[model samples]
Target: MGAVLQLLSMAGSVLGFVFLTLCIASGLYYISEIVEEHTEPTRRFLTRTIWVIEILLLLLLIFDKFPIKLTIFAMGSHMLYYQNLKKFPYISLTSITFLSSCIVVVMNHYLWFKHFNEVDIPPQFHYDPNYVPPRRATFSQVSSFFAICIWFMPFALFVSLSAGDYVLPTTVEQAKKTDEITELNSETTAKLRGRTIGLARVVIHNVRKYIYSVLALFGIQVQRDYDNLGI
Candidate 1:
């Protein structure tokens, strides 16, 4: 009885983990949907945010005497990040601008990490009151810096940007075009040429569909997949 109880506890823990993970993913999906819907406003917000960050970095570089080289590098990365705005919310995953931005974010993180570590106070001076600490950032400073400058932009872009399928979303006008193409040649699959929903919607719809189909195959029906729509 004890062994059976232990097994059940472990199984319960596993289910709880899965439930939390699904909750997080669903929240992210919902946020992405909202961002895509308000593309113009999202774009404007990101653009203005870059300007504000740039000004803050400039102040650090000028007054705070942040490492000049690192400051310039951070500014350059922000510039690269700005390039993604040209295409707005929809960025091609493999495109040069997007790939370069990813690389720059990683590089900035490594450079800043190494810089801070180098400036960290040595252990030998721990008891020496006269031994002044190096101009290393404090806990609060580091936290605020990373939160505002280093990590903020990349995270913002991650949530705001979408690498959608190459096919555009079908609309009323595009539906007419698709029908014409289909009529011209039944061999042509114009139906697949466009997606009717956003990328997140597509993934959620397909995954739920596959799960339901699998359950049916196993003669298990927890719920019916009546609606094909997902945000």
Candidate 2:
């Protein structure tokens, strides 16, 4: 019986992996359309394809074999945070929001593995008509990789602010001396203002991180409750 269950679990995992592949592929196509300035229809089609695949994959988690309902809920929460990035679009907010999405995806995968370990599964089954396995899974890690890429924004902001503090003259004396040499010294004041802006950006970035961290913490708590209750 355990052997049969293991086989079934493996089958579900394979299907889940395929769903991930389709999502990534369709996402790439959507991004490509954006990059190439393609027509609205092409971009919309790609987005719709990804959404369909995502919903079907969530169904598999719920009803296919392992009862991954909690994982699906966590995924939906990620989508909320991702939408927050769209609404804000600031570099720091976008970076943190995107990283939050990545963390949520990782947690979902962890839940998938946990479900396989715990649930009783059927021996064998075939995918539905719309489900298609990828020829290679090399691109499967792209989502996580993109999450890593978002980290660069925060890092850059931090470094830029740190360097600006060292190099940008911020003293009242410095400003006064420059004023005596030239009226208002617009160039010097502009450079100082730019540095101040960089410092402000760093603060904003950290604040966004805190907001997303709170969301992620809430998600983890909900996930734990769902797992404990077997919901």
Candidate 3:
């Protein structure tokens, strides 16, 4: 009975992990779509907020209120993220900015993990047996610090950053061109209804290809079809 229960528990754990991974992938994909759709506004908001945080971290460091090393690291990470702004909406996975962004993510995760661990486990001072340790951080204080100082900007940048390979036309002229092409090939009158139906079929096929490309990001296997929709 105990073995059977253990097997069930292990199965449940595996299923839970799969579900969580799917949720994260879907959420990231949705965020990337939104960022691609609103590139300019998203860029401005992220850039401004990052700079603000960098300034605040500098001030805290100046006052000797924050760990100087961690503060400087955080500020540097923000600067790296700022560099990507120059190539906004066209991030190369192999570019310096993207690589730096990846590094900073790991750095932030390590720094905060260490910080929280330190807070939770006070070091023993062998020299002073009776020396009292400082008070541990409250849950709210820890959460606030993690949200604002440790994870906020990094996570936001990760979600906002899109691969250059997936770049899509977002300009007014490009959109107009797409519309014109679609209209030129699609017939509005019943006399040309057969052509319209064919165009609709092609559009549906292209949409399926787009969805398959998105799924490929999650390591899903898909057969590619290069048939272009008239547009």
Candidate 4:
């Protein structure tokens, strides 16, 4: 029973990791599409947010006794990521940024893991008979720290960072397509109304034809009024 439970637990962990990876990939693809569609706006938003985070990290390094080296490395990595934004949608630059961002994520995870481990460990008093250590981290505290420090920024970036391959149609192309569709619809409407045919009748006639085709696939023969509709 214990072996079965252990196997089940390992399977669940593997599945969860796979699901998380898929979610991150899908989110990055979606963000890349949005970034391609709105290049300037997306770039501006990312730039501002990255700068804000850099400032916060700088403050934390200055005042809080956070690991200065890791913090500085993270800041530099973010600057590299920001530089990639200037040449938006370029494959090489984006890939570099992604690699740097991954490094930054690993650094953050390592630093925070160290911090939490230190917090969890009770301090040792040298050869003291009456030495009392502080209480260990509660479940809530550990969970909150993990969410805020370890997972938050990386998960957010996984969703926010845009890939290079995902492309949206250009604004001009979209406008042209919209105009063409509008013209085609108008022309079709004019032709139908010119024949003194009601729009509802046209829709019903098309629907009936589609229904008959489906019925025919099921070996049920239904009469199709193709000639009388003047389609």
Best by TM-score: 1
lDDT score, residue 171, model 1? 37
Q: Could you give me the TM-score of model 2 versus the true structure?
A: 0.30
lDDT of 1 by residue, 120-213 (tens): 5678987888998657678898778888898988877877776563344553456576566445453344334443234455556577788888
lDDT, candidate 2, 85-135, per-residue tens: 232222343456555655665665566445434533333425455554433
lDDT of 4 at 181: 35
Which 10 consecutive positions of candidate 1 have the poorest summed lDDT?
188-197
Instruction: Give the lowest summed-lDDT range of ten residues in model 4.
Output: 192-201
Model 1, residue 213: C-alpha shift (Å): 11
Please give the lDDT score for candidate 4.
0.58
lDDT of each: 0.76, 0.44, 0.66, 0.58
Q: Report the candidate with higher TM-score, 1 versus 3.
A: 1
lDDT of 1: 0.76
Model 2 residue pairs with clashes:
none
User: What would the TM-scores of all predictions be?
Assistant: 0.65, 0.30, 0.62, 0.46
TM-score of candidate 1 to 2 decimals: 0.65
lDDT of 2: 0.44
> Which prediction has more favorable lDDT, 2 or 4?
4
Error of 2 at 159 (Å): 25
- What shift in Å separates residue 124 of candidate 4 from its native position after superposition? 9.1
